[model samples]
Target: MTVHFHEASQSVTTADAAYAGLDERHAVQSGPGTFKVYRALGKRIFDIVCVLMALPAVLPVVLIMMILVATDGGNPFYSQMRVGRHGKSYRMWKLRSMVQDADAKLKDYLESNPEAKREWDHSQKLKRDPRITRVGRFLRKCSLDELPQLWNVLRGDMSLVGPRPMMIEQRDLYPGRDYYALRPGITGLWQVSSRNESSFADRARYDALYNRELSFFTDLRLIVATVGVVCRATGH
Candidate 1:
């Protein structure tokens, strides 16, 4: 199966000679001559249903985490501008998992520690980041810090499964323009594939591949894999 993305239409065209036809509900219009079928519309419905189902369990956990994050004196929630589908911008939310002056501390720490600076420059992350609070460290280790993003999913700023959202400055790190066609997700192909263990280049590759082979089945598989990844305490 080969998948081609059309930038003009912002649609993905799956061209698989051996595969059977797609259901009408999932079909998206390609340009003039071609007909492309993918689950873009269906995916949105799935996201809404999944978010609604998860909210009952998720809300209480979010409330607890909010208070815990506020212990150090600051906003319990953090929001940053992130690039979404079609290069649009949205505020991506998270539980505050770092000190209030995290960015400033990062700059100072980078200046003092050459090894940490190298890691940050390469991966845009520091394994032993000094900006993380004690509570923040625990939140991050178990992936609880990301719970607030369920709101992002509820608000349609993100999907349940898709590409991980990127910071505006990190947009260029994505390998292709095709990536902009899909909305970023709270957890995605890269998250389950290797979590934080993968390199930047490897993450981009997974993102592209996910977009190319996107389908209802693929999304379902990724979602299931995500649960297992979380259970193993393997996420960053």
Candidate 2:
């Protein structure tokens, strides 16, 4: 399957020519193609417009997060590089939920506990991580930590819905080259469907499936389901 990265939206605007499909090394000429075109020219236009439309509702939440972080004595926004379509890297931004030196603490924790290192080998999260601050834990559980990602969507680095983007290290940890075909999304099938409970292999399967069948309606379904999951606090 050819993994394609799109402007994390419904816009046709581009810094690069719309990428044609992959080179022949990964071509599949004889199969019934199930992939729908969710990440496409017009889809991005939809995304940009959606973000603008949603700003009225989204602003209050963003302001709330900013207030908490600012009062809590930490940076309000966090940015990290993540792999996007075709393995290209982009800065994925989010609201900060950890202490300022969360990354440094992760390095220390990994070195101190062999068991944690074992989990980190395949899955990047610790089961009971100590680095997440109080507000961070609440934000993550409530899905509020991701509010800043809307800006990422507006910037075209990611989409509002699709496969979830992984940190740079996580991108390298994934096992397959074909997985890069889809752009990393803020909320995707894996996220609303299983999220924190899912294993790496399960996540890879869901993302691949979405890539094989990308479409506007399909994405809309995912987005609606994502809202349900978040509102119900059913998935992390």
Candidate 3:
């Protein structure tokens, strides 16, 4: 039984034979690929350092947004426990996108709004959620709502780039996927490459691909691309 995983990247075919495309499913399966040395440590160390350094820059944005949420809304920040490396669950922070009771209201909205339900069914996200605050709409469009996750990155809960961590419900939806094999990332391959339009299955494929093809330079490329992504307001 040969399972396969492929993702977007500068492909590094290794020297080992007999195990082409060896993935989370087959560690024993060897493949001829450039196994970048100390890639994980390098990636994590850089994540901590860069994110910590970025705190000062991010704080102002946080302060401004907190006021926006507080004056008109309530709670400037919200945290949801997302599944991380090896099935570890940790609180992933974000600037509040929807009303405080958004989670509780989700069920009712999903039942009533079939169009919203379809989008969520396909992408695990509601495209035009009415529950989202006015400030949140701009925040989502500008990708500003995610600025708070720098805290998560600093706290060692996430990476600047990696497989996008899934909410427990989202992870449960993809029960067949290997949730425990890799760490949850702040921005995954699917996010940088194509996020809003991509289907969940397609996103899953890219996630697996990124895991097999992970590297420092690749991560660097993702960081650079992220700026473009933000400027273009690519994330929904």
Candidate 4:
């Protein structure tokens, strides 16, 4: 699972390489496997091409979802800061899939329901969340809530395939700064692999793995798998 880091400036010196390869006891904790330099340019090109190709279909759906979200008497779009590559922050966009004042509602609901509170504490999610509108819930089930991120992809704030961005509070959970090396994605290894069913720690591992194994074939496979996940309405 170890892919050596490339790039001359970030290169591993002989001494450091030896130290990293030493017995597990003496090994340096260098996050996950190294980044694949060769994939860098190709990945961006692929993201652009794919997003452009999907725009015709995606735009219409986004417009319809906007109307549906607005019918609930709230803003149809949501934007929140998410940690991006190199620990920089960016506004990640989404179609609103929750009621107005969702945070406040979540607080009130959690205070009243111990079971829901526990679920939130464990996974930061609730299988039956009370904050989501009916339309929002359906959008979320189909992962349509994330369609607005096509703009993020287009703007270079995200990739078509990479680790999903984490909240600022989840910063420490990263294996190291390695998670910050790649732009986050709307769908990724974690989403297609287990979605909310996997624990936070497991998701982190998957994120690291995806960062390591990125390539044309890898991205293609994940994208194809993501379609199946969406068609099955298994996303959240």
Where model 4 places Cα greater than 4 Å from the true spot, the runs are: 1-38
Q: Give lDDT: candidate 3, residue 220.
A: 64
**lDDT per residue, candidate 1, 16-98, as tens digits?**
21122433333552331222233547788888898889989988988998888888999999899999989999999888888
Highest lDDT: give the candidate number. 4
Cα lDDT tens digits for candidate 3, 32-85: 233444344677788888887888887898899888877656778888889887
- Structure candidate 4, residue pairs in collision: none
Candidate 2 Cα lDDT to native: 0.67
All models: lDDT?
A: 0.70, 0.67, 0.67, 0.72
Each prediction's total of clashing residue pairs, residues at least 3 apart in sequence or on different chains, is: 0, 16, 7, 0
RMSD of each: 8.0, 9.8, 7.5, 9.9
Summing lDDT over every window of 10 consecutive residues in candidate 3, give the lowest-scoring window: 1-10
What local lDDT score does residue 127 receive in model 2, on the 0 to 100 scale?
60
Misplaced by over 4 Å in model 3 are 1-36, 175-179
Provide TM-scores for the models: 0.81, 0.79, 0.80, 0.81
Model 4, 1-236: lDDT tens digits are: 01112112222132133224233432242222222433657778888999999999999999999999999997899999999988889999999988889999999999999998888776677989888899998898788999899899999999987776788877765555556788988777666555554556666666666665565666766687678667777555
Candidates 3 and 4 compared by TM-score, better number: 4
